[model samples]
Target: MANGRAGELVLRERRSLGGADWLYARLRQLFKNSIVILALAAVWEVAPRTGLVNVTFFPPLSEVAAAWWQLLLSGDLGDHAAASLSRSLGGFLLAIAVSIPLGLAIGWWKPVSEYLNPFLELMRNTAALAILPIFILLLGLGETSKVAIVFYACSFPLLLNTISGVKNVDPLLIKSARSMGLSSVGLFRKVILPASIPTIFVGIRQAGASSILVLVAAEMVGATSGLGYLIQYSQFSFLITEMYAGILTISVIGLIVNYVLVTLEQRLTAWKPSARE
Candidate 1:
């Protein structure tokens, strides 16, 4: 009976040890995944305080966090954030609408591609910022101009990616669909689209990043309310902490937007192999 009791106790201890080991391994993986972010944050938190960087110009992370918290409480951040988001989403959605169909036509029709390629190349090469004055003159310093700028900035990547994706679709798949007596629209819908989705999402992700950048520039140049304007306002007033807070807010928003797009892409393309996996 004593021997049996000893065995039971040993088995319980082994189970407990196994649980602890599993938990430790999970924690280690989490740490490994987050190490770079943590390291950068630690440096940010320490550098200004240690005088390795000027504290006035570049406030410590803690001060920036405090400012962020204060802004959150004041409701200023939300208002500005919403305005910025509306502009970005408006322009991004518009770009998607314009690019997708046009890109498909360009990719599918030889005459369309021949007619549009030179114009696209010229517009794509022209810097959007360089034409800011022209946009201002044409559309004024209103929401229209900003949204147009964002649209122009985002459209090219998606258009180019979409064209490439459609063009590069496997001949075998196209021939198979044709063999099945599928209509042109049916072939495009069933085969070409599904194959091109992965590549199209790559452009979408790139456009997401570009939209944020263009929004910032637009807001900085001529806007009353936005995260970018907040940063500019804070900087001119010499509120370094608030400036950092605004910048951080933009970073967080951009990350969230990118994450959402990635999640959407993963869900939509579950059949495709994941680079992360």
Candidate 2:
């Protein structure tokens, strides 16, 4: 009984030590990852104050943070962020809904792909921004146009990646599943879909980034409320600090969205071996 109790104590101690080690390692990794961002921030803060850069044009990071805080307090940031996020999410979701199934169909059906290849090639080669005027003319300078442009910008990446994922699935896996007497639908559900998920997520991340970038540009045109509009208005009014604040907000939002998607991807692909491992 005494030996068992001693063993239990030892195990508990080891577990505590393991937990501590893991926490320390995580903190160290975080610091290493953050070093470059910290260095850039330090430079931004010091350059203007030390006259390494013109203070008028490039205000210190501290000033920008202050402006950002003021905007937050005034509720302007919330309102603009809401508008931008809504537009981005609307377009992004629409693209996902349309692209994924279509890509799967195109990849699976040779005839369908052959029929659409010419048109797909032509449209994919055309830049989203290059056709912005057409969207504006057709949809008008309203939320519809902005959302349409973002949707257009985000669609190609998602569609192409989905097609690639489906086409590139391992033939051996499909053969093995079929040999096991799996039906076509079962084979797709069990093997193809799982195998294609990582690639689909890659497209999702790209489309997410494109959605933000394109929406910001679209908002700059005729938007009365959005981060892009805020930046533009601030710049025109010579509110440089506020402009920087808006830009900073957009950057933060991008980082957050990317981090969220990465986390989701990691969770979904937990069975896959990571390079870090």
Candidate 3:
């Protein structure tokens, strides 16, 4: 009996070790994947120092980092970064608030959808940047104009995704819901909206990207502070290092935001992926 118990303990220890080994293996894969970026950075550092590339127009990454440091030390970085983030996220959320119910209503009511489709198609296709002048005229080029552009930029994706999700709900599910005597609202809440989450999130991601792009454009137009404004001012003053630094900030911000959204998506939709697996 002692020998059997020892054998069982050994097996349990081996299983625990195996699980840890699996986790370490996955971490190693992630590290290996990052090597490409390290190689690129090394090449970037070397190419400029060697004078193989024109460093004046295309500043080295180090200069950009130094410029960023300068900006941070000057205490202006926080305000600008905050402004950009506020505008981007603010628009994204506003878009979500307005679009979801409207999209659902349109999708649920065939006549409403038909009537609105033409206008939505036109509005979605319209250039968000082009409306800058109009917004300036109406909202006076302050925070409101910039935020409005962001809102407009983000709105289409949310609306489209919500509508598609509602419309594409399975007919079989609807039939079953009807047979079970579920009310219309119950069918929608239980069957359609839940099913649409994945597609809706795709639109949300796309709109997020669009929101950032429009924010940059709006900032370029007339903003005292923001990442886009930094880029514009740097370019105007021929401060290539500062310009690239601004671009770097934008890139890092986008990556971080996308990562957060992706993480949230994965967590919220955990059941879908888990079920599929």
Candidate 4:
């Protein structure tokens, strides 16, 4: 009985040590991955103080952190972030809803592709920012215009990628499914759609990035609320530190958005051999 208890204790100790070793390895990897960022931060904190850069325009990292904290305490950061997120997410969701279905149809149906290809080619070639004036004129310089511009910017990537995903599905997979006597709809649902998801998500990630970029530019052009507006207003008012703070906040938000999308992509594609590997 005593030997059984001793054996159990030994097993538990081994597990605890293994867990601790894993944690230490993870932390070490994190530090290694972050080394460049840490070095850059050190330079940013040092350069202005050492007069390598003008302190007036390029405040140290500490000053920016202080300004960011002040903005957070004053609730300005939250409000601006909320406005930006609402506009970007609204436009992103709208693009996803409209683009994916149309892309699938265009890719699957030769007639539909022929009918729309020319128009799509022309529109996609035109830059979204180049047509900002038209959107503002049609929708007015309100939330509608901002959302519309973001939608326009994000749509092409999603549309193009979805089309490519559908069209490029493996012929062998389709043949195999058909050999099993799968119907058109069943083949699409079981083989085509699943195969296409990774490609579709590539577009989704691109559009996600575009949504943020276009919205920031739009807000910088004209707006009363948003991180872009905050940065612009701070720059104009000569609140250099605050402007840097807003820029930093935007970077952080972009990183968070990208991380979330990547996690979602991993979850959805967990069955893929590459993902499992």
lDDT of 4: 0.91
Model 1 agreement with the true structure over 1-277: per-residue lDDT tens digits: 4446446655775587697785786688899998999999999999998999998898889989999999999999898899899999999999999997888889988999999999999999988788877888999988999899999999999999999999999999999999999999999899989899888898999999889988988899999999889989999999889999988888888899899998788667766654633
**Which whole-number lDDT from 0 to 100 does residue 136 have in model 2?**
89
Model 1 TM-score (2 dp): 0.89
Off by over 4 Å in 4: 1-17
Is candidate 3 or 4 superior in lDDT?
Answer: 4
Candidate 2 at 143: error in angstroms? 1.0
lDDT of 3 by residue, 30-111 (tens): 9898889888878877788899899988767888889999988887766788899998889889998899889889989999
Point to the candidate with the largest lDDT: 4
Instruction: Rank by lDDT, highest first.
Output: 4, 2, 1, 3
lDDT of 3 at 73: 86
Q: lDDT of all predictions, in order shown?
A: 0.89, 0.90, 0.85, 0.91
**Clash totals, every prediction:** 0, 0, 0, 0
Ranking by TM-score: 2, 4, 1, 3
Model 4: clashing residue pairs? Answer: none
> For residue 207, what is the lDDT in candidate 4?
97
Whole-structure CA lDDT of model 2: 0.90
In model 3, which runs have C-alpha deviations exceeding 4 angstroms? 1-20, 274-276
